[model samples]
Target chain A: MNTYDDVERTGMSTQDVEETGMSERAVLLDFPGADDLMAAGRVEPPSAQALARALAGIEAAVAAQEAGHAAGRKKGAVATAPLRGMSGRRRALVGLFTAAAVAAGVATYTNTGETPTGTRSETRADTASVFLNDISTVAATQSLSSGKYWKTHLTVGDSYLSKSMDFYVVNDGKAYKKGRQPDWQLGPKDLDWKALNQLTTDPAKLLQLLQTPPRPKSISPFDQALTLLGGSPASPKLRAGLFKAMAGLKGVTLVGTVKDSTGRSGTALEFAEAKSIGRVIVDPKTSSILEYTFTWTAGASKGKATHQTYLSVGFTDKIG
Target chain B: MKPDTRQHEERSDGAPSRDGGSDAQLTRSAAGDAAAFTPLVQAYSPALHGYFARRMPGAADDLLAEAWLQAFAARRTFDPSRGSARGWLFGVARNVLAQHLRRAGRQEAVPGVEITDPWQAVDQRLDAAALAPALRRALAELPVEEREVLLLVSWEQLTPAEAAAAVGIPAGTARSRLHRARGRLRDRLAPTGPAGRHLSVTGDMA
Candidate 1:
């Protein structure tokens, strides 16, 4: 009897028998007959040694992460992460390079402790150095491990620029998770250096544009928390307005030294400029700004060249 | 931070396996508790392996390893109230797999290892072994969503609810798709004549 005849005799519906056949056929075709494939030198289930090796890799990774945490604790790493904001100026500086160029720049600057030269008017500085100069202390820094960092480049009439943000962090050695609430208000979005640079490359035009701040459609959670906690980053025109509003507020200074368990110590300093322009952080000991950064962009507009500088402060603990 | 060390402490502390722990414990484990997550790793590794192995052939081992690593690195992001630890883990694994595929720029199938059904073993009129590969190819030919639903239920052995959870689809939609996929497969395997449409073998179909 044919296949269907046999199914009919066995009291199976046409559909049911067909399903059984199809499932079996798929298994048969998807994998060459295991016995045949094995005979032809196919590897069977992963060798036990391979599995052990995999488990070892996992165990090592887990151990390293734990050790990092313990080391952080010993260094007086703050469990409470501060509001680390990416100033509009800092973003504009790095967004002008391609991915390859960005990678090269990050590698050179981070490894040699020197800044990568770029076409922008300002001298290139390592992101950490910029933070140190702006903030007295840095909480944490980890390079992108997933190779997913996209790089971009910027240019005006004669100048082309390449930049990179090799390491990202908060103050006092507190690691920043993407979605966590900030201790103070930063911004509503996670604008990378590239996106920022694009906005501010022309400082004059940027200042003009800032007269009416562009509203981002979606804001990140970190920015949301930052807004709730304290001051916010405003448009250039609004920033000027904020400085005017908080002009009478007393300016305060904060300073502190953070030493990781590894014996790596960095100093942090914080300055409340106008309360509304927000606070500026700088490493008094290293004379580096660990967090706060500013960039000015100038693009031609209305037949006149213009420039605008944006100010942002890093979060660091210091007494001033 | 080793799971072994954590395991020892939990034993001494008289805390139950993490799967049996309160939400707080699960949350802590997700944050940075290596020891707290040991049970989670043990519990879900098999299911995760099975999940990948059934869909993409030969990927079971690598995907499993990557999934575990991702689960740990991203442990902080896990939201316990939204779903179970296993469900969250499977979601991460799927993302990781998608990322890997996108980066690698190659779509290669890892051949599956076949397991025979015991009932079919006793009545060997039709060799199921001969049918498996054909079915697999046919399944591949189906739309990705339909094939996913079919294999999720048939190969991965997930009930409709569990399958829906894995793929982030509604249960009823998944059920309907599964039915259509199976029906499509059957039609392809043995073309049915219009004459056969009148017969309803199971009183349910009429």
Candidate 2:
């Protein structure tokens, strides 16, 4: 038997291979056509513009790391601060200010014309709220469509749990895993096709529904909202309502445009609580959730990020 | 069968120790020195860009940029003790490719059918007309993992060990895969056979 050792020893020298009685050499050299395949696969080097952009991106990341290190040193904290890159941080701050302004505007609109100290509050609108509202409007414009089944393909990864899972669910009235035969349920709070379709499209009502429940304390209103957004075959109006409701949530803040795991760029929204942080990436054009990630901010699982990418979601007649 | 001289010159840790600079540069870059990363980028960007271009021709530039940013962010995780920086970079590229494919709703490996006869599974997607038809058919029929290893060696010019590192497989597995792929290709392309004669005529036409 010709072993791998004999193959490696034959080397890349044709002359030496001919002198040595190695069958592996003949195997390696017989495919002269491989050279053509290699030539065919050749591509031109990256253009100067692409190279420059890549360098700039790297430089920004470096600068962000350095800044994070400096901040950590000044605070007497560990040098493990999250590196949001310079551009991302700037965008996040801008989004925060916008969200804050929008909250103030909403508060002022609902104000009874006086505070505890009998002073009137000022009204303002920030960027993130406006962005989300705009997205909601676009989402509402999406034409409603339906099929026999609502199909979703999702990939989930959790660093804290050290688990990776993929869910391909096709739901008509009942949920099926991958196809019709096998029954499926997605976690404890899973809603069936009927529950999903019956979800009220009213933004305020949707928020109330998500908040009211005998749910675990760990499943926050935000988490519930995201779960529905990801798993449901909600109509265009419902999706718009979901975004509008999420926009009003206390801790939800825009993180600017960021790419998901799949490399498709989308606007990112983050909600940081006492123990964990949740982030959702939305394709504003279609108002669809591209990805959702949650990371523990404190305790044993601190800094471990779990994420789910919604590869696709659509209505299909057949389940597979 | 020309040996890739660069692979031979690499240090045990996998960093090219040609001038004893890459390892030091990588360390400095990981320490947040942006300037140190420039040389490393210049050294590997062409091959890395090619890696993306081969699989995803249209979005190669954007994918390359994304991969570099990711690599820079994760630079601290690159242990020279495990593999060379090139192998590490290629691994990153592979990940980027996987992500891109996932977003596009495509599988990296074409599953299901086990190609027995090359003619039955000729991959019409490949545009390499200059390559022998029989060999191309044989290649298209090779299992995705074996094909990946073979290409990383024959095209990317990585040794079996380096290819293993790039593909996140064991060195022994990579060598055996390479050996099997070579033997299969030779068998399919043997000149004395009637199938081989038919393939040669078709190869010229192509």
Candidate 3:
């Protein structure tokens, strides 16, 4: 029978169906043999593991919100809470760091035979140095894992230029955009994976490598350092050296703890130049780059910021 | 005849009768009650999970988790006065799917791109299994806007008004699109006999 007959069989006029909702089965009855097609399109329900993970995420999120509310109540003003009320995850991280610092203090005393000094206030420069060094120490301990391809998923947001876009670039022997075709010249440099792999991990030598030609003269040493840290699969030792080299750069300063674009909190370090300012947020515990932001300080694009959030990065056997 | 209030009674406003107390639960959940929110998650997780799985199989779990997280963060913004919570949730899922496809550089899979067929993957599956090719072709030929409305109704089991909420269109517009889509599919699938010929002439007249 024609589709009209099928609808007529439902005993409701088309207008009646529209004004008042039709039954689920009646909705598809107008299309001939749609039941079979709909059945074919059905997929199995979500795995129990997926459901559990989703529930756990919701629980953590709700807990964080509750903690924020409690802190706000105790402080009498909501504004004061953010200053002292870290998320459960961040509080745990702080506790771990405190324990690590005590252990480091004991080691210093045993090795050098001197009493540990009392805590003192630090200048911004000292703070930046100490933070970078802590990240370097963590980075150095990470064991390298290998796979067929090094994949980096990044979301790029430009405040003035255009809308934010997310894209992934994968590198094997050659760089590929979304695992599609070879991207010969990506970013600022004509990236040669072979050359990048052979670069020195010595902090002093890496600093020199970043300063020389083939690295564009216009891009600051700090910006180039971030590009290497973010885009390439640098070994843990190399990553450690890069952070150390950045610690020595003249214009680098700590922006303190801040949340990245994806709302994950991390330590932010800013690098100021003549015409632009650049910032990179790092998850110090894991020594992974969370975000990189660049803002033009002069000319037509002044005050406009470009934020690139590093969503996921790792070596994977397959790319898609 | 008295209008069928059966479907309307279930999904009239922010408070659906089928899942009673959801509106109150949503409000409590927004107020930072995790326990109140657990029921909503348990109720909708299966349907939302299926929604993602059909579109992007491998990344479905991650996408589902991300969608729920985003939904929770923005729960305060959900106004039940406008539409059903279920429809609003599906709207969020649609946006998540679009963002995912865009991130993956799969422009063709992104919705609102009318010319490019978004059903190629689903079509291939049907084709491989030697299932209804004619119906599949008819569906694939429907414009993205109409096909989306139809699928939201047929597959997701949303009412036309609920589908309208999901697609971010007016209820009237969604109904018309549903009407147009069903009409076209009916025409295409009609048997090629004198009856079909007569129906085609009538369709042309309409």
Best prediction by DockQ: 3
Candidate 3 vs. true structure, TM-score: 0.49
- What is the C-alpha lDDT profile of model 3 across B1-206, one tens digit per residue? 33434344332122343544666677677544745776777778877887777667676776776667656655655657777788878887786676555544554744445221246565665675466777776676666788788878666667677778877889889889888888777777765544345344534321
Could you give candidate 3's per-residue lDDT for residues A23-134 as a string of tens digits? Answer: 4447544666666656655677788877875665565445434543554455475443463668866754554464455335323322221222211111233335545555
Give the number of the best model, judged by TM-score: 3
Number of the candidate with higher DockQ, 2 or 3: 3
The models' CA-based lDDT, in order, is 0.36, 0.58, 0.62
Among residues 3 or more apart in sequence or in different chains, the pairs in candidate 3 whose N, CA or C atoms overlap within 3 Å are none
B1-206 in candidate 2: lDDT tens per residue? 44434433432222343524666677677655745876777677777777766666666776676667556645655667776777777777776666555444445344553211122222432554456666677786566677777777655556677677778888889888887676666556666576555435435221
Tens digit of per-residue lDDT, candidate 1, span A1-320: 00111111222333453455433223312222222211211113444443443343345334434544665566666642321355655433333232234334323323332332221101112222222212211112211121223111111111111223333233344533234222221232344334442333232332233233224523322222223211222222222222221211112222233432233333322222211222233223222222332222223322232211112222222211
User: Can you write out model 2's per-residue Cα lDDT over A147-225, one digit (the tens) per residue?
Assistant: 7656666764211100012234434445344322211122233555565566567877665565555245677777777
Error of 1 at B42 (Å): 3.2
lDDT of 1 at A104: 45
DockQ scores for all the models shown? 0.08, 0.13, 0.14
Candidate 1, position B186, lDDT: 52
Candidate ordering by lDDT (highest first): 3, 2, 1
Candidate 3's C-alpha runs over 4 A off are: A1-29, A79-320, B1-20, B32-35, B109-117, B128-130, B192-206
Q: Give the range where candidate 2 chain A is weakest over 10 consecutive residues by summed lDDT.
A: A117-126
- Interface RMSD values for the candidates, listed in order? 15.7, 14.2, 14.1
